[model samples]
Target: MTTVHQLSSPWRHDFPALNTKVHDKPLVYLDTAATAQTPLSVIRRMNDFYQHEYANVHRGIHQLSMTATENMEQVRQQVAGYINAPDAQNIVFTKGTTEAINLVAQTFVKNQLKPGDEIIVTEMEHHANLVPWQMMAQAGQLTIKVWPVTPSGELEVSDLKALITDRTKFLAVTHVSNVLGTINPVRDYIQLARQHQIAVLVDGAQAVLHQQTDVQDLDCDFYVFSAHKLYGPTGTGVLYVKPGRYEQMPPWEGGGAMIKKVILPTGTTYNHPPLCFEAGTPNIAGILGLGAAIDYIRNIGIDVIRSHEDNILRYCLEQLQHIGDVEIYGTPKTRAGTIAFNLIPHHAYDVGTFFDHYGVAIRTGHHCAMPLIEKLGQNSVCRASFGMYTDQQDIDCFIAAIHHIKALLD
Candidate 1:
């Protein structure tokens, strides 16, 4: 087991809002999985870019434009390094994870999928990962196959062989479930997909915040994640396509930046994948802030963050387990910080609202995994997600609040 204090996060001080009090009490933030609190370093980096280096990238010959372009490209390189992508050219910035997934759906899947083709996804996927393929399957006259999750909150790979046939065109799944906190065995899944010659798209929105990812090692054809969940700003995320895949996939959108030349009399020529996909004026400041966030994580080390989170998760699980009338969800062997649970005789939203009264922030409702919630025999759940800065005190406060709420409700 890793020592928590030895792995103290150095970037904690960079998030100024953590020091602020809510309702005359120190705020207990437990919704990091939805969106992490941004560090001051990242905020300052973005502010500096807007204040001085602001300009439209990849367009003008002026000095400011060149500087902005250089900065934007530098961040791309940083993101490449952050995820251990083989080349920086594989990193394409977008609005967030949803857009990144849609990019793949529009560009690659749309072109490749056909009637009788099938796409494989898990039962625990978020709507972002689930809906795109559903729409694609509907339009292309394809079949959508879902892999089963065990009652113990683990993905059942026994059915995988049956699911992947010659008709399998693509496999899309989450690296870590946002609601269940179950870390899926993505490498094994990727290997299985490789055997069937099926391309895989792994949604890293939840995993990227906790796990140390190497896209090359995973060997997935494509990976997507949002920066906000990783302590960066909102409106910034990445889609990393393998070099081979990137070369084959076309641009999803048409705009000023995506074109190399336009012949009105004939046709239009498009730029290569990364540039071709980024259609309009990109989120320059958000991209810079994302780079700073990656820098912040590197300075602190991912291993350290993972260890700290695991410790806190274990403690929270133990504490919640001890509470009477409380039932926890997703008891996976190797879970992350996200925990979903409910109290008997109380609604999840009510519990969430009660916790809010004590300045404890958590997520409630279906958590954008309505299908999974139905599978779990519920409509909604209370979710508490931890970050690197989250410690034992936050968990204690949360547990105490739950106890108090339960008492009042009873």
Candidate 2:
């Protein structure tokens, strides 16, 4: 019951996709947790790069290469600064969060764990965070431990005491639950993991736009996030390790930019941290887009965006709660951007499709976390997530659409 006013997102105009119309209705994009619409600034930046500054970085001595190299490296520094990392050198570019986590799982965790070692993860984790460990466990013969979720769909970090045994080698957790919008108390779990000398990886794909991230403050061993989630281009991601942690991991992939010297007869000496981890020519345009995205977030201010999103979250929840037949999932103690629910008799896909025909976009089904949806006693749930460009009008349109769909279905 916070004050409700005609609050519109000031930056909505910056995203041209929001202006799209379907069947004469304006697009009400509410699937941001899945993927947000790219801002014009980011689009323009990528377009400009391809038009003018396109070149392979780290391997060329020419002017275009140098410029591209400088800009790409500057993005690394920008990402480090954005997350408050101790140094930009610790950041490695990957395809996306999925690759970043898999990089760690493949390079760092795989080498360190023995047959009896364990890796701890929460029930609320996205499949990107969960499946890699499952695969690793099968490959390395390691035990995968689950940190159970409360009824409200939050990790019971207090339960960490029992899970982190002497055999625990690593722990991976998501900063925010994509399904529940629950913000886990990551600091508490990280601290506990540190006590047991277990390395931790935090997946921040759903977190970057919701609030400011300080990896230094969180003291996590490693952090991974996707650029597209933060209004950047796709095919670009960040994997940040602590100052000295990168040395512990050998290169995950091998290709052009990852090595310093390649002797056909002898062998190859790899590049240092960031470059060593980034194999091949890399996604030059996407990296530049990520830089522009960081610039966009800086100019908008994450704190300002967060306050606006929090207000919208409260407003949307209050409105949805009014529907007696609607059953919302994951009532977290504290939530940020996403919400999932089911309107009793209607299938989630039916609700999503009906809304889509009317120009509203929402995510339906397990959301890549089938175990969690099943744990909550459902096969599927509809999720509507928010972003910087989402506003009251979008929510109102969604609500109105939902009521119409409910009536039609009933």
Candidate 3:
């Protein structure tokens, strides 16, 4: 346990935002679950693209347009390689994880479900995963079933097994819980869903930062995540469709590059699977930044980052547990980078604000998982999550702020 205090990240300098001073003190950023601090490499990569190689892609013959198109396509391939996707075509770019899930929900899953068919979602889902299915189920007169979370904030496979029936056509579950810090065994769930011939979509928004993702290994019909959460620019995301699934999904949106050809006053043919889904001019600079972010992760290796963050998470959990008033929410056996808790006599907002005043940043609220919060018998909780650049000093600063706030409030 003493070695945790000596552990420090060598890559802390890569993120320029960590050097920022909040209220005359160095920033102690513990809110990576909300959005990670962008590294200089991603910023520089986007700036260079906008300054030198700026142009629209896939619609022009000019040199700049060709260069931008090549770069964007290369990033698509890079994303594919990063996730061990079978082909680049399986990767579809979207505005973010929310849009990606909606795309699958509205088109692919919706197409398959009948009026009485059911879609299963877990209580731990973010609104992105839950709301879309709810909307679709309402519109189509389909039933929505929930897989319950245990008292310890972990999911039980037996609960899911009991929920499955012939009517279960689709399942949406998170690879990791953003609020509870639960690393769900989604691959096993996927296998179970496969046995019942149900399609599964794994939301990887929180998992990608701390775990090495392999789409083929998970074998989900669809996987979605945002680039921003993975240390890239905002407004960019990836949705990977399994082989042969895209051919079944009709385009969710239509315009611009998503068409093969438009015949006015007649029927129009659509482009291939991914291009058909991407619609309109994409986020060119953001996609390039996403490529740079993946490159950055590759250079340092995901295993190394995971080991570093696991230590930080273990230490942070230990420190929080040492404080009697602190009530940690989830005690999942396997978790990665986040912990949610609240001080017994203090509201989460008060504690978070106090932390902010002392140059510490932590997320406080439902974390867009209101149903899970309600299940935990709380309206909201404070969350502290780690990143690849998080180190022992940051954890020390955060712990000290917690003690300071406790002393004052007590």
Q: lDDT of each structure?
A: 0.90, 0.90, 0.93
Residue by residue across 1-410, what tens digits does model 2's lDDT show?
65645357889999999889987888899999988889999999999988998888887899999999999999999999999998889898999999999999998898788999999988888999999999999988999999888888888867888788899989999999899999988998899888899999999999988998999889999999999999988899999989877767898788887888999977999988888888887898999999999999999899999988998898899899878789999878889889999988889999999999889999999999988998999999999999988888888898999899988999
lDDT of 2 at 335: 96
lDDT of 3 at 164: 96
Q: Which rank order by lDDT, best down to worst?
A: 3, 2, 1
Which digits, one per residue and each the tens of the lDDT, describe model 3 over residues 310-378? Answer: 888888887777877998887899997999999987999999999999999999989999999999999
Q: How close is candidate 2 to the true structure, as a TM-score?
A: 0.98
lDDT of 2 at 144: 94
**Separate clash counts for every candidate:** 1, 0, 0
Could you tell me the TM-score of candidate 3? 0.99
Q: Candidate 1, overall lDDT? A: 0.90
- Candidates, ranked, TM-score: 3, 2, 1
Q: List clashing residue pairs in candidate 2.
A: none
